[model samples]
Each structure stands twice: as structure tokens, then as C-alpha cells.
Target: MTRVNHQHSKGPHEMPATGGDRPRTDHGHSHHAPPRSVEDHLRAVTELLGRSPWFGREPVRLPLEQAAGRVLAEDVEAGLDLPPFTNSQMDGYAVRSADTAVPSGLQNQHEQVDATAGNPGAADSTESLTSLRVGPTVPAGHAPDPIEAGQAVPVMTGATLPPGADCVVPVEDARPSGFHAQGATVSVPAGQAPGRFVRPAGDDVVRGTRVLRAGDRLTPLALGTCAALGLGDVLVRPPLRVGILTTGDEVVQPGTPRGPAQIFDSNATILRGVLADAGAEVVAVHHVPDDDDVLRALLAPEAAEAPHPDLWISSGGISEGAFEVVRRVLSGPDVAEFSEFLHVAMQPGGPQGLARVDGVPFVCFPGNPISTWVSWEMFLRPALTAVTGAPSTRTEVRVRSGDEFECLPGRARVVRAHWDGEVLTKVGGYGSHLLAAAVGVNALVILPPGRGTVPSGQDVVVRLLT
Candidate 1:
């Protein structure tokens, strides 16, 4: 078990000391301490996750099929040339360039013979066309017999070029405009280049060339590239193992009967889906009622079973409310070695907490469904990408706002929006409990702290969601 030493001094983000080693539990909200900036809280989360043992664990080997959505741990080099041999790039006839070149006497004569001159003799002339006897047909994936100097072999696309053939003339350029039987004559255009319609060996990728580098995510196209390189497996970083806990007596499992004051739990489902998309494996999920002993027992070292999680994430019970089970249990002196619960200067996800419980990192998010999601996107997602490089980072683009909106003073407004390639329109209200309203949101518009109305057509930064 690795222990992280965090300075417990009263810094800018810390509240006044409560006269003990353990930091005071504000339940993620305290009127005394100023709310930490979004950037500062994000930096803290990044550092916490970056220093853990799970971040430095050895890479694992997985088959190519199973490597999708995983980060590559090492560079992958091509073992052989992509084409491996000279092949025809089109379904055509392969012939030596010299055989297609016009004779010097004929060239000089045809140079002055213009069919556009309206001369019957020039229009009917065949002196510029080169005729060659067609050899054996070369289908794709078949080796071809050598062709003589004046012979043209009918070759399909991707068929290996027959020996002695230096170029291919596409069937569309031939006089017949179609393939001919062996031993039949075909008329081809004169002056064909040596490498026309031919794919040379190593054209796409050369042997020993680095095709994929370390820290690259194995997406669908990436996996296809590995398959094209004849690789059966690849080395990738193991996913971060995570445990989830949702607290609050008012929260009940979905599909079960609920009391008058209870609401169906959506935090657990949301966290599971989001964590899976971010490439983290959820090892366990538990719902802890607003009871300190129940929450404490579940997080105890003895209570943890095999396949222990590298980190724990809990939603609800961290706010300033009276029944904040997570804040009460985790911030206790005997429960956590280091813990801090504070508010961030961001709307919808202001309350947050981070701690080290039994040498494992634990991150606490607010109870609201949108707050939990926004916290993951605003802080945890970026931190994971920075530390591990799996689950590629989101793209932020500055675009014109599609609608006019007001901003709050001293707090960043994270509003869900839809990006239409040109402008960003707000999707749902800014309330954290409007989870159902965020259905079609694909972008997050981040408006910095200010007390004024933003007119339409003003530029705003947006983070695109995958």
C-alpha cells in the first residue's frame, strides 16, 4: 500500500483548521472557506490520480479484437511491405512500356497527322495504335507466368504483375474497352508510362516502419490497421479498476418500489456507463444508506474482497445536508488518512471531495445526477486522459453562441449545448437536477465568471462530447 503525503495546512482552498489532523468536514459546502476555482480543483484531482500505483502498473497483452478502446503501451512496427509484390492497381492489361512506345518513323508521321483537320486519311489511320497478343489471364492472388516482349497479360485489380511487364493500361483506355481471350490481339494506346496503374512493393507501408506509437488508443480504424499489418495481438495499458458507491436513504434502486420521498437511483447507472466509456472497469457497485457504520464497513480493508478497485467514486451524501453519509464516514479521523471536502467555483457541480481511504484513492461527487456527470467531465475525465492517455480527450472549440444568455457572478456556468458545426445552442437548463433535459446534449458551453448577459454571436468555448 502506497501512502500519499498531502500538506494539511490551511491554504487558499482549505477551510479554517478544526484543531485536528483530519480536515474539517464541511459536507462539501462551508460558508467560511472561499470556493476553489475550477482549475485548482481539477489540478488537485489530476495530481491525486497521477501519483497512484495503478497509474504505473505494467501493461497487459491483449488480442487485437480485445484491444479496441485500449491505449497502446508500445510502438507497433510493420513486419513486411504492405503489397509484398508489384501488383496491378486496376483491372487492366499489363505490357512492357517499350512495346507500347511508337516507332520513331511512325511517331514523326503521326505527330503531324491530326484527326481534327477533317482529313479522311488521317482520321482512319491506325499507325498510332500498338497491338499486342494477349497472354494468360492473371486473377487476384495468383502468380502469373512470364510474358514475352510483345505480349500483354490480362490482369485483375491487385493481381501480381507478370514478369517482363513494366506497366498496365486500364481496360477503359484500350480500343476494345474489355478483356480479350488468350492469344487474341488487343489495341492499346501508345506511349504508356512504365509505372501506370501499378502498385509497387512497399507502396502503402514499408517493412520495419512504425505504424502505431505508444499511448495511441486502439479505435476501430486503429485495430483495422493492426489487422492489415498481420498482427494478432498488441500490448495495451490495463484499464483502471474502479468501485462505485451511491449514498442517501432517499435513493432507491431502479425498478423497485419507492417510498413517497424516495427517488429511483440514477447515479449508479450513470457512473457505470460513463466509466465504461472512459475505459475504466467497474469492479464493484454498492448503495449505502445514510448510515455511518454501513458506509464504514463497506470501505474497510477486511470488507474489501479480491479484485480490489484502484479507486472509489461515490455520488450523493457529500453535500451540506444533515444526512451526508459519505462526508461523515470518510472524513472521520479513523476512516481516512487524508480527506478534504470543498466547493468548486462551478455551477451544478460545486461540491466535491477527495480522500485516501485505506491507501486507495476515493473521489466524492455531489448528489444531483447532472452534477455527478459534470464533475466527471470537468475534472476526472481530463485528469485520466492526462495521466494514462486512454479514452482520448475531448476537443474544445471556440464558436459563436446561437442564443443569448445571462451569466452568474464569480461562478463558471457549465451549460449543456448542441453544436451544429457552426454555432452552439444551449440544450437544457443549468439546473443540476435536469438530467432528463440533457438528453440531446452533445457539447458543453463553458461561460467564465462574470455578471452580464452574453449576446448571440459572441464566441464561447465548448467541449465536445463523444
Candidate 2:
């Protein structure tokens, strides 16, 4: 396996010089210092993740269509203006504003029948000639001849406006109606101002303007802007590669026959979805038995083989149990340096461990389904976002508990709860394995240590889970 460029950093379990003054409770007895705070452990994990090579590496070119939902690696400037040329905003008559500057209510009552053809019966009226004769139509995609001084051009919507035309009168406003079969005459509205209903070049966006900046996520709208700016491809960062391993002989695959103590493995499914939601590309997923030998053989590096994943996220076998396969194997000389494996002053997810196995970062969590889920949200989610610059999945909101709630004396409570826009209500009992209580919970109520019971209507800090 290709070894990651490992960095030496202090583990979360290492106590600071000031920690010696704090008291630690062991087996109902107060000792020298308390367990590490949640923020302290989170800081250490973030530090480790920041040293990863794939967190924020060099950029790679990708097609614009495939760059959606990924971070842009460089600023993209527009090559041409949005409109590229002046165009008509409506399918109507394009006229010079000076020709339509007549006052409102000026009527054109004189009728004409080709005076140039020598018809004296048709009287020639000067001031009564308020209507201008419509010129040739300017169809879309076909250039039109330049408009004359006293003439109006019939231009369709999105058609290029002929030179010397300053405004467009919608087809509905024309006296003779829209483009006609025979030659048409259009009435000019009074007080028609310049630039009215005319989409000028470079109005929406100018050429060479910075349209999209580096580190911006290529959302659907952002990608559309890139396409509009004449870009077919963009530079983006690749997704993080991760390997998931779920342990426990008692946990069998779904749809398989189970013995008396075996149950369907839900951790794998839950963690797979969780890692994907965190923007990690899960390259490999395996269900290893409680045997240490089988686990070691599958992970050992082979000659001329490809590198392992950038990171390994394992669930179960890290807790302090008799048959902890992961702990038994990684603690040996051949595999890794097991750094931290202690209670984290939090409920539902108290057991946690961090190690570097075969130069690949490994983060082990408790076996319980609820604990594994909570640990990811509480710790791994923030760490990944900080290192990889992924979007944040958390939000803090103040909420009032619906009923009286009690918390553990020394451990902080991260209870699954529901927030219905008004008040937050606690879910089922506080067992670490109570997976049923986690359903439909949009928030996690965080209660600090040393609190017995909180009365109803008290405001509590909660992390949004949606």
C-alpha cells in the first residue's frame, strides 16, 4: 500500500499541563483529572485531517457539465458579453426616439393611397402624417438593413436591433398590429424614450469580467453562468476517497440467515450513506469478522499493488470489550500506533479511537448503531469540512425543551430530539443502542455535564441534524 505523508501531531488523549489539576472519576471514584472536553478532541482530529494530501490538493480540469456540486479551482472570466450585441426585447416596431417624440393624443386622420403614383384625389397632409411607414422585417438570426431617419423597422423578439433604432414598441402597441402580409404602417407612441425595451450589449455581463471565483461551489446556477460565459470546461478539486470497514461477528449481512445472537448489520448501510453525504467517495466497503488474522491479511500491502484508500473509517471493535478485533490487531507492532481510546465526556458516543495504520489514517468508533451515527455528526463531520472545505452540515439553534429532562452527572448528554418549529421534545430512552429513537429527529440537544434535571421551558443549545 502507498503510504500517506504522515505528520506527527499530538493525540486527543494527551492531557495538557493544566489537566493535572482537574479531577478524573474512575469507577465511582474521583481521580486526578477529568476526560477530555468535546472541543479539545475535535480540535485534535481536525489537525490530523488538515495534514491529509487529498484534503485540498492541486486542481484538475473537468468538463463544465461534470463540475456541478464540486468546488471550482480557479476564477473564470467571461470571453464575450452576455448579449454580444444590441437586441430587441420584444417583437414590435423598432423606431428612432426622435420620430416618436410627438405629444400624446396627436391623431393621424389623413388617409393616403400612394401619392407618388399620381393620385390628386388623395390630399397631402403634413402635420396629419403622424404614422411612420414600417420597413422590412428583421427576423431572428438574419441581419436587417440599417433603419432610415423617418422609418420604423419590424423586429422580432431577440432579433438584432438595426442601427439608428433606439427603442422598441411591442407588437400589441402597434396600430396595424404585428408583422403583416402586405406593407404595414405603425403608429408611434408619444413620449417613447431612448433605451426603452432595448437590451443593450454588455448590459447583464461585460466581456472579461470575473463571473465566477475560485473555491466557489459549482451549483446549478453557477454552472449555467459558466456556459453563458462560453466556457466548456473548468478546473475543480477531486472528491475525497475513503474506505469503510464494519466489524463484529454478531453482525451478519442483511437478507442472510442469522443464528440466535446474530443480527443484520445496519452500521455499514448507515455509515456508507453518511460518508457519501459528507462528500467522500467510498472506494471499498468490507464486513470483517471478529478474527484479527482475517482482518490483517485483507489489509496487508502486496508487492506491485496499488495504494490503499486515503483514509479508513471503521466502526466497532474499538470499544473496551474482550473480543475487540480492531484494537487487538492495530495495537500490535506490525500495524499502527493506537493513540486515543477513551470516553469523550458525551453520551451515546463515549468510546472513540484514532490511529495511523500502515500510514493510512484510521478512525474507529463504537459498535452501537446510534453511537456510530452520533460520533460522525459530532466529530467527523466538522473535521472533514474543516480539512476538505466541504459544505457544513450543522447549525446551532436555541430551543426550549417540552418537558423535564435529566442528564448524566459527569458526561454531557447528546440526546436525539425533535424540533417542530416551536419547542424541542426529547425522543426515546437514553440507551446508547436505542436506534429507534433517532428516527425523524432534526436536532440533537446538547446538555452540559453536572446537570441533574432541567425544567420545562428552559432554552437549550441544539445542533440541527437535517
Candidate 3:
């Protein structure tokens, strides 16, 4: 077991780990007092870890080259109108209302109104006209002059409306292109509105409007919207630098096996992945012996400089074992009690906690792989997003379970699962050591802490995994 050695006493201004040593069995379980409820313990640590208050956040103007996963810093507005001008809603002929012989011309308002039951265009078709031939074609971008009284212009869908002409008569409504079709007369239909088939400028989004508001997450759809509006870059918050530590005398790395007393270090890799997914750039992942002197030496300023860590995360050494980090932190004459780690009422990942020592946020999680994962997803995720100004939310999606599963009562079980559209199928065995099952799982089916067993076809809220 490790213990902190202090040379001299410091004033109250100094900050140190809290708690005295509590005896533990050789295997490392604790003999301390029964732990408080997980929620209560979490709340206690948060209140103590004001080291979080020392952190600073800055805004950045990122070119498209570095914008992925960054939190947006400001509002983005449309620089110009979408589409830019009034256009055709479909491919058809743009004809003068007066040129066509049902609606009366607006010049004779009274007669026009009388041509039909109070409708406007009734007299134009009935006003009596001979024949009008097709004029020039109007494509999408440019506009042509108004339709003259004796002609019609062919217009493609999305073409800006000419100086005149409103409703479009679909191409099918007109005779086809050859002599058998073109030049043939078709009966006139009565009562077409003036602006019928025209799409007005700024119809989709008007210029100078706030297209995206401040703090909005830049999704692919949102990013596309900005690009369509002509923006090549976005303003967002810079990524945070985090310091990670994995603590355990028995922990080992992957691809290596130890005799009887060792297991691989899954916490470090799991946390790296989690932190990256949460948008943090790890400054250093400290792997130190489970000795307080070694940990303190590794944590000293000389080990890392320049851009200091904005936050730190460590696994294990927090329980009541003689070598418990929490105990060593609190026991030294240089150390001061700040908070305690709690065993929450949750399955597989119960021994999780967060603390603040000396102005740096420290998230202490269990050494067990599944325990660390659950702690990260349940607690640190929301907290990190909030601190970094990310517009991320822990989205809950409804899905049916494909199979029946049972879990410990009074403990929330975070089961791994695959979302197959309509239902979520539980992944391999619900053991904390099941890394394979947790790695590729796309969703987490959370059984309410202590909630009952879920049978097939039952509704469950799945936490999406990215």
C-alpha cells in the first residue's frame, strides 16, 4: 500500500486529497463504512471539486480544415437569398394572361369578376384571343423580357420568371413538339391565378436571416446548409486537453498475459476512445505504478509543461484498500480531505466517482472495464459536453428488445446492444470483462437502476453509440 509523505505543513490555501487510510483485505476490497447512495456521492464530489472553476474556455475561428467535432462559437447567417430570384416551379410555357384567350384581362376588373364566380382570372381565357406562338426559352439562372401579347416562352423548372407571366401550363398540358403535336390547337382552361406556378425569390431562406444560432451543433445537415449559403469556415470552441491515468497494481496491457494476479489495462484505451469521442485531445495518458509517491511524482509539473491539462481522469486506487488512492490522497500531512468515491446502485459499473484536487477536475472511475465505460457514459459525458460548450445531448431513443434478459434487482444495468432499426438485441454476456461485446455495440440499453427484467418486445431507451 502507498502512503503520502509530507515534509512541512502548509496553510489552508493549499489543496490536497481527502480521507484517512481504511484497512482492506489483501485482495483489495475495502473495510470502510458502507458507501452512500451513488447519486448522493456524485453530488458530494461535484461540490468539492471546485478545481473545475479554474478552467478557461476560448472561442476559435476554424477554417473547414479543422471544424469537425468542435463546438460552434457563434451564429451563422445567410449572406444571400436562396435561389436569388423568382423562378419557375416546373417545366412549362410562360404565357401572357392577355395573350391566352379563360380569365378576363385585369383591365376590365368588373367584367373579369363577372366572367366567373368572383374569381380573378376567369375572363382572360374568355376575353377572346386568336393564337399565340412560342417565343424564346427561359432557362434557370437568367430571366427574359415579359411575354408579349402575341407569344409564349418555353421555361424550364427553376428558371427565373420573365418580366411577365405567372402560372405555368405543364408541358403535358401543351401539344408535344412535332407537327402532329406542335401547331395543333388545344382548348383553353378557365381561371388560372397570376402567380400560380412561380417560385418567388428567397422562398427557401431569405438573405440576412439567422440560419443557425449560436451554440448549435454543426451536424452534416447544418454544415451543408452553411456551405449552400456560401460559408467556408465556422467559429467554434477549441478542443480541451485532458490528462489520463490508469491505476492498478494488477493491471496489464493487451496481448500479454500475467501469472494468476494480472489483467490487461482496458481502462486507458477505453477512456482514450471516450475522451476522443467527447472531443478532447489527450495531452498525456499517464501509466504509473499504484504507488502514491510514484503517482505524485508523475503528476508533478515537471512531467508535463506548456499546455497543462484542463482535466484529468484516473481509474482504480479509489476504493478502501490500504493502497487506495483516495486514502493516500486524504491521509498525508500535506493532504486535505475533499471528497469520497461512491458505489452507485448500478450493475457492472458501480464503483465510480469524480473529484477535484488542486484546481484540476479529476474523474476517478473503477478499474473494471465495464465499470469505467458505464461511468463515462452515465456521468462524465454530459459534464464534458457542458464544460466544452458542446451542443451534445444524451439522446434517448425508443426501441423494442429482441430478446429477454434478467439483471440484478435494485441496480441499473447498462447492457450492450445492437440497434437493428425496430429492436435492440442484447450483446454477449453481461460481464464487466466483455470488451468484445462493448466495442462494436451501437447502443446501450439502460435498465433503470434496480428496474426489473426486460422481456422480448418490451420498450427500452437505448443510448446511441457513435
Clashing residue pair totals per candidate (backbone < 3 A): 0, 3, 22
Tens-digit lDDT track of model 2 for 124-184: 6322233778798899888878888777888999999999999998876665556754256
Q: What TM-score, computed on C-alpha atoms, does each candidate reach?
A: 0.88, 0.74, 0.74
Q: Per-residue lDDT of 1-466 in model 3, one digit per residue for the tens? A: 6421111111334233333223322222243535445466545444533346324657778776567666678888889998678888878776656555444454344222223434465554433223446667777777587776555567888887777776666664454321123333432233445777888878889999998877677777778787888888998866777788876556666677654656667678878988877778888887655556666566554665447777778777665444565335533324322434556777766765554555666777766677678777776776666555553777788888898877666676788888878767888878776665566688888777544577899888788875
Pairwise lDDT winner, candidates 1 and 3: 1
- Decoy 2 TM-score against native: 0.74
Error of 1 at 404 (Å): 1.4
TM-score of 1: 0.88
Q: Which pairs clash in model 2?
A: 23-33, 24-31, 24-33
Q: Please give the CA lDDT of all the candidate structures.
A: 0.83, 0.73, 0.64
62 in model 1: Cα distance from truth in Å? 1.2
Ranking by TM-score: 1, 2, 3
Give the runs in model 1 whose Cα sits over 4 Å from its true position: 1-31, 103-105, 108-128
The C-alpha stretches of model 2 lying farther than 4 A from their native spots are 1-33, 55-58, 87-95, 102-162, 166-183, 187-189, 197-199, 303-307, 392-412, 415-439, 442-466
Residue-level lDDT for 421 in candidate 3 = 80
| Top candidate (TM-score) | 1
